[model samples]
Target: MDRLARRLGLRTDPHIFFWSAGLMVVFLVLLLSFQQPIGDAFGAGREWITTNLGWFFILGVTSWLVFLIWVATSRYGNLRLGKDGDRPAYSNLSWFAMLFAGGIGTVLMFWGVAEPISHFASPPFAGVEPYSVEASQDAMGISLYHLGLHTWAIFTLPGLAFGYFIYRYDLPMRVSSVFYPFLKEKIHGPIGKTIDVFAVLGTLFGVAVSLGLGTSQINAGLTALTGVPDAVWPKVLIITTLTAVATASIVAGLDKGVRRLSNLNILMAVGLMLFVLIAGDTVFLLRQLIESIGIYAGDIVPLSFWNDSMAQFTDEGGWGWQAGWTVFYWAWTVTWAPFMGVFLARISRGRTIRQFVGGVLVAPAAFTLVWFVVFGWSAMEIDGIGGSGGPISAAVADSVPLAMFAFFDQFPAATLVSGIAVVVVALFFATSSDSASLVVDMLCSGDGEAGPVRQRVFWGLSEGLLAASLIVLGGEAGLAALQEVITVIGLPIFLLVFAMMFALIVGLRRERVPKPVEAPARHQTAEPRPAQESPPRAGSQT
Candidate 1:
């Protein structure tokens, strides 16, 4: 096997790849084979955590935000990620575009319209009347809150940590590198390998969540537009088809494949948003955009700390709301952080610490606010005016996959717009899979070498298989189950993030202090320095 692998030019940490993929395949197989039992178990465990540990997710994410800001504004902010004088490999436009494409562009597409509309019907707090003006305002506020800085802050930490340690210290680009300050040479030992393994696993599950949801939305779009049956088989087929597409890109490597795909994803997304903004309520969206920013800015602090226990004027939906929405979003972001972190670091060489934090936490977040404003506010206005017969609300209630399509239904050339939305989503799905495969490959091969095509293709296939299995086994229920499992898995990662932050601070402080030069030996005299204005030496050319 080794000789054959050598001949094929396929070099990888076989244990990392095989163990990660092998374990994933085993788990997926068991879940598919015994869906009911696993779903039941997951559901029970999920409820327990959502009920008990909701506060932890809230606190963890809030601390991450504070920590990220401090790092950005601190004395270390000016430090370059790479050696002094190194410049960014990619252009700023491509850098930010890929950030969105990798982090949660597909997630936004899946939920931008759907979540706010859902919140409009049921505000997070107890007393707000559903679908009322107050409800609508709070809905966008909370949606922005979730998709806004708090979430970005979570994603930024690992990226910042990875970039700082990996490039600055010449450390290998892997999840375990974040712990180098604390672990030192131990990062190469079993503990370090374990961290990397968990990172690969976390990334696998995180990407699966997006892939499964995107596939569901694509399935819904097809059914809505073409009268295609929305069944497990169709979703499975969608996964298979798109995974093949993603496999081709994954083989092309990051610069050619992921970068180009991400740029294309951003372009498609911008076109779709522009179409909605212009074709939908232009003035209303503009007003909502300004208002949403104020609301998010004014209420972000309270909202960041808002949890079931803190809901003073309570309702029955208190803890349930936190679990279903806030905790779930945080958990999802935390789980996806490993993949986002590595990918961000990969593209972030030559940037300063401040530039990285600002770009990761600010740019994508600003885009998210605008996205929710246009998609969320427009959906709310349409539903509010349309009443019970409103297409947007009805879709949100019955089938979230169809919500984006339903939102487009209120506009001109609805079918064309919906078709475009589907294509954009497909590309988001592909970019996400392609990037994730790269991250997992790095984890397996234990560096940023991009590994071999075989390894990338292997992880890509594993991701698709896991996503397909989850969709087929549990459908929407299965996706929820997977999310619950993710939140559960995120407990350790949450702690690891805090450790990384501490390690980063220590690493930066050490870097900031210049190493002292030793005195010359007592017997040895220093060479005399030449005078700057000295005439040319005899051997100098004049």
Candidate 2:
């Protein structure tokens, strides 16, 4: 049997491809056959889970924090990324792209338009006074909570676990690496190959979902602003266009294309915000910002654990949709974690775990919340005092950028907001495509940039191709199916994330070194590493 398996080239790296495909098929079949029953069951289950597992996530967050602290204070903090602790793998732009792509930048594009309005319509707590009032401060709170620390913690665990074990421990850089420490020695064989297969499938499903969502939103925005039809063809066309661009950038390697695109995207996002602050509702917007921040801080916990209780918020006909949003976001982040984490870990040598968790996880969350505050707050002001909510609301469920256009064109600033929107979308899509292509290349080749330029280009085109296929399939259902697969396959890795946290903590404590020993007779000591994650060198950050 072993001889035959080897001859057939059967794998040993947690070959989960068949399993992921089966699991996703099962999920979809169940979705089609027992969706109502499953939704009802899962809906209640999530509420119960939230009520019971509030601490589950909190525990996850806390443990991750401790592990980070340990790394900062240990010999591990002195480590860098090269083969023998040489230096970083890529330039600043390339590293950031890898992180941002997996970090949910596309969601930022989606949420900038949809989230504020979502909270405005129905915040987490009914008792809050702002429930029905347009531009309720509570709404912004929910939006922030959705984009808050816990969400990143939930999502980042798998990535960190996968990266440390795979990249750090010299295990194969696959999602299956998370389960390696637990699998004993057998994980290096066929069973491990099966697991890796599932992980790859999981990543594909997740990326497919992202591509579909991104294309839809982009298509919707283009349709609203331009006279293009919001149909299957346009979405398909956009996907094709994006994939072509991604292929070219990936081929150009990280130094040239990926970094250039990401920096451009970040700059555009800043410029768009600046335009709103400069030309949109200045006074009302300032007031909205304060209220939104307060609402976010106060209600974050509840929003993070919200379960619809069979109550879909009125807009979707039940709070279940909100539940879907939470669950889906968590899974998407987890699914993308491995690729992003590896990419981050690859670039982040010479830095402490504290820095990685803090900068990558914490800082990004802060930036995202701020972005929400600016865009959502501005939209809320328009909704409350002006009739901006009508256009925003009408477009919210469809495309976020379109919704923003409606809100921004409120009075005298129509053309200015429109111009900003154009700039943001252009950079936004480029960032996503470039990062995604790089990630796909990593999976296809051992290194992120190892493939020949043309090879990377082929993979780059694949991203757009699958997205176009999804568009041809039609409707939100197609997109939802793709997302569901990512979430389902992403489920097992969550446990692996917890396990990695535990392992890192244990490893750190066992090997922890003290600063210096002081005695009465003689105060002699050797220099010690700092008790925090080390900062990256000048070149790495750049």
Candidate 3:
């Protein structure tokens, strides 16, 4: 096996790479072989987790947000991720661009319009009438809540841990290294390898989910523009085509491929958001942006902790809504933590803890707010304030992937903007795949360096294949299958995240305390003659 790996130019820790890849392959085969039963299992698992463990998910995520806030504001905030005086590798623009592109770019594209409109049509909580003005406010607020600080906070914790350990303590760049404070040298033992294996699986599933969603949205765009049918094959072809692009990007390495594409994604996304804001009711969106931010800030605390226990009995599908939306979002983000954390750590060397947390939590989140207001609020207005059904809301209900294009159809250059939307989603898809592949390679490799081209390509193709298999399971059932898988897998990773928090706290405390220097040993003979070599003068050389 070693000889074969070398011949194929693969540099990896055989244990982690083989175990993680083998398990995924086995699962994929099982999924395809017994589609119905496996799909049903996924659904059942999702229901069980959401019904029983919903509060754990809610509390876990909220705690992450509060913990990050405390870390950012406390005295520990000034600690640099690297050695003292080290500065950030990427500039603010490039850093923010990469963070947005890698972390949430594709998601924002997929859900910016769909989520808000869906919530408007059916508000999550009781007492908010769907399609009413208050419902619209609630919709935007809920959207922001899901995508804002809480979501980024999930990424921030692990990223901070990885960055601190990898850069400051000179630990290996793996999820297991985050627990070095507890595990000590045992990080290289089976326990650490197990943690890394789980990281690989979590990352694989997480990125696969993003790829699946992006493929769906891309196919919907194609269907809108070229009259192509939205079917399993089309989705497969989209995934295949973009996965190839991602493979190429990964081959080119991070700087040449991921960074450039990420910057482009940000530029294009900004252009789209600005177009929506200006072309639509500019005043309404501007007002909505401000009002929605206020609403989100005010309601964030209560909503973060809300589990809908009372509403579950009183209102129909109340817990179902929480399960489908909030819990799902939390679990999804949890799975992505390892991936995003590693990726963020890669780009975040030399930055201060405060800068890292604040940037991860605020900048992308601020853009997310603007994105929701522009696309989401615009879709809501086009869908109408009252219960009168509109095309955008109808599209969201019928086929979520088509929601963005449906909104585009309302504009003048429907085809052109939709085409642009397709390109943006495709770029996001590629960047996400390639970056995730890069991170997974680091996890699989013995050292944290990029491995052979074949290894990168292998992981990249694996993600696409896993996504394709899920999509082929039963179209929408496939998407649901992946969602359920994420939720279930996230429970263990969620516990791992808490352990990481504890380890990070321990590590940070040690970092802040000044270590005492050992005094020179006293001479047994009491010879003090050699102590008088003092400096001659302030300006004179001795």
Best by TM-score: 3
Instruction: Please report how far candidate 2 places residue 437 from its true position, in Å.
Output: 3.5
- lDDT of candidate 1 vs native? 0.81
Better of 2 and 3 by TM-score: 3
Look at candidate 1 and tell me the lDDT of residue 394. 86
TM-score-superior candidate, 1 or 2:
1
As a whole number from 0 to 100, the lDDT of residue 492 in candidate 1 is 70
- Backbone clash total for model 3 is 0
TM-score, ranked from best to worst: 3, 1, 2
The per-model lDDT (C-alpha) reads 0.81, 0.56, 0.85
RMSD (CA, Å), candidate 2 to true, equals 7.2
Best by lDDT: 3
| Residue pairs with backbone overlap in model 3 | none
Point out the worst 10-residue segment of candidate 3 by lDDT. 533-542
